[model samples]
Target: MFTSDYKYKDYIQEIYKTFSPLSWLLKIFSLDSLSRGNKQKFASSYWALAKGALTFTILAAINLFTIYYKFTWFYVELIISVKYADAVQMIYDLCQYFVDLYFVYKYGSDVFYEYIRQYAYIDGMFGMEYYGSIRRRLINVMIFMISMWFSSSLSDYVIWAIGFGLMSTTFFSMAYIYMFIKILTNLHVTVHIMHIESRLRVLGDLIQECYCSSVSCTARIEDAVIKKNWFYTIKTKTSKSQLYPLKKISYVNSNEVKWLSRCYLLLTEQVNFINRMFGMRPVTAPCWTKGLSQGEGLPIITTLGRRDGYRTRYEKMQAAYKDLLSLVQSQPINFHMAHFMRLDYPLLVSICSVFVTYTIILIQSI
Candidate 1:
């Protein structure tokens, strides 16, 4: 429903068109195919093996040189560079690349693997294809960011890319290298989102099951009790002292009801936590009925609260549960916003503004 403005199928086609051919060569270890979970064989088939081996042999010389330059000679170049700041930047870039590489290899792939599993497992409560679309867009954004690093590396390290008359060979050569960096880093974040959603979905399913089972069992017990009371009235005495019609018509255990209510409240709390994290405005059912009432756990009781009060409590909890489902269905996904947890957009802007201000001061002082 939220994808009305987004053309997912078109973008999926674009991804296939752009990446299908070189996927084998690009994912030397089949990481891309592995990341997709299933139904793709671009990485491990006989043709993929033959083509990847042939291409690696073809690019072996340059690949060797590039790897050595990145891990070793780049740092050595850093110490000798005249512009220390940009040199430091190159160091940071390489470090970010390595750290992101480790994260992607170790957790990112597992995350996507689990994401696909959970998406299918939960029958697609996975929400917006944040796994697919945002990941691609985030990689695009990071590729733009990488351009900054590449430009600095060219000016500072003088190795990653070098210019020629009309075009640069190094620039073309390292395109896949940077693209690899972008994919890994973006997937790292994508996997994290998937993992969290997977856990939340599991918890939600458990709570729903409990709610169903408990409510059904209570209904059966209440039915049996009412029948026994009717038989007693027919067989025995009915006097003014005897309350013959009085039977426990409702056997919804108070503990079970309250526990479910608490579960519902906790579910909403978690949903709001994720919403807050993603910079989404709270899906407030009046901020959880005014935080379960003013200051304490109990609301101030008024005489008007006399009409089927348990039903009102049940309705509130039920609303919270449904709201959690809707929030899950919406799946907040803003790349810049998602990147910063515990800090909303205003705070992020303020931090950036302050940093820029201080940088200007330091530059003027220099």
Candidate 2:
């Protein structure tokens, strides 16, 4: 899932798929067109995004300014004197939109190189199909998010189209940022975790084969030959001080072991990086330890990650693939809604919830 043989455009395509419309907007920001453009001839890739965000932020500020200037605006009689809550909430959301956009601008290149260029560049459909299954895990969640947004939007501005229209552009700005965070997170999961899953499965098989194959019997045969040679040496020397031979053990699958060891180390490194990227434990593959150890027990895996207090790497990976993605459960989209939020579900829910919560007041006031 995270191969590096392909070019950067593949990532653009994948990122593009998350939401093509937003990708198009980001492109105007030079996400693709000016990727190779120098600042001499072009501005920063985030220029368009920054300009767009600023425009919306300005609009929201004006609305907020108008609301604040009214003085009585804070206490809209929307129930028991909510006081500045709605105004404050909208201001907070707009600020959040700024923060989200800033993260995108700063990390834009690093993310492209790390995910799209390095990990998300899969070569074939066989791997993609498996990865796609894991990716779709969030589809239900996405559907729920979209539906909630629509319903809340429908209910919030039933009679106040003018007010809603003023607020709509501001909210759209935040939604764009939300969508960007989502696409980035999904790419993270699809490339890192799913790729880990696929690699670990392959590793488990390799480990199982290395351990289960006949390494022990070959040693026995070598021992028998050594004994025979020892007898012949004694006869040939036939006297005096005896010479002794030291037995040196070797892996029958030494080449295979070396290859597997390299593969395992690389795979674990990848897992560690991904886990750390989102502030999870450095050794997260072990989250699947119990599941992988079920039914089949370990069979002579010395190079496993067990000594460092993690389960066998392969097993952990197996479990990781089967387990529910726990990167950001409280979030509708992983890591996107993490921490503070002014815009996104928090803001959307705030606007709608507050609107509905005081809908009765609106009816009375109107």
Candidate 3:
């Protein structure tokens, strides 16, 4: 199943096989790039592309037909009856349908394939340790998928019990699919960010270890002079280290420092690449809980933002080491919403505030 074109074919195949079930599900919805046939590669499969397009066409047609039917049968009655709330809800549902269709189509193209390639490249560079436990990830994905389906089914039953028509329940089911895709996409992006953060953490630990190795502690006697009316008393004190043998002096070589610096630069590049690739999705999806969790979980980037004190601690190191520390300190990684706003606490607070304000207004008007 491995293709000859990709260098990391084995790794790509392993990853593809590990997540094949998820891939199959997404493929059915036209939201993934993995081929249905046994072929695996780091590039987009024409078979997947054709199948996804056909699937999307069919789904899009169904969505359009359902929207038309709902507008004609349900929303028209609501609007004629002056049920503003129901009419507004219908409009929102229509908008959501379009958004879901757009999301599926956009991600099903070569863009997702490129993302897979970049991910595989990063995995090859960092090795499997940084990727963490694949079996655990698969288990989590399965549990999440099952929970989503269960919740969707429960909601469908509730919708039915509420006297809604079959079409109405079907629309809600579609909405749930969109919600599932959005949350799963966010989860995958968060995992990627975690992987990058792990490597950055290792780099930070290496810097600390280098500093520790290069440190040479010397014991010195400190003389304190106290003068009292025509008398002088001198007190000499020695550090506790003077009582024991001096530890051997070791230094972090320039080559190691240079290597660390290069690694830091490469990692930063990957961060930027990820931001560029996945930035728009955050802007579109805008999930609060996931955004908040990511902001809190990613501490290394935040630490880099306030790295002045961190840099000061390593000021006495060699020029190369200092440069590496500066490189680490200068670049602060934040998941941005297509360069509009950062996905952090402030963004979450702002979103909640706006929602509350509008909700209050909506209730008052109603």
Question: Which has the greatest lDDT?
Answer: 3
Off by over 4 Å in 1: 1-82, 124-340, 343-352, 356-366
Question: Least accurate stretch of 10 residues (summed lDDT) in model 1?
Answer: 295-304
lDDT of 3 by residue, 105-127 (tens): 55544665665565555445434
Per-candidate Cα lDDT values, in order, are 0.37, 0.39, 0.51
Q: Which pairs clash (backbone N, Cα, C closer than 3 Å) in model 1?
A: none
Alpha carbon lDDT at 284, candidate 2:
21
- How accurate locally is residue 363 in candidate 3, as Cα lDDT from 0 to 100? 56
TM-score between candidate 2 and the true structure: 0.43
**Clash counts for all predictions:** 0, 2, 0
Candidate 1 residue-wise lDDT, 1-366, digit = tens = 113223433333333433333334336633344423344313334443354345444444544555455446344643333334433444444444443333333333334344333333222222222234434554575566657666764564344334333123352345445445544434333433443343333333233332333343354444222222232112221111111113422333344334434433444444344333223221111121112121211111111121122243356544544444444334332222222343434766599679979975764454
Error of 1 at 111 (Å): 4.4
Overall local distance difference test of candidate 2 = 0.39
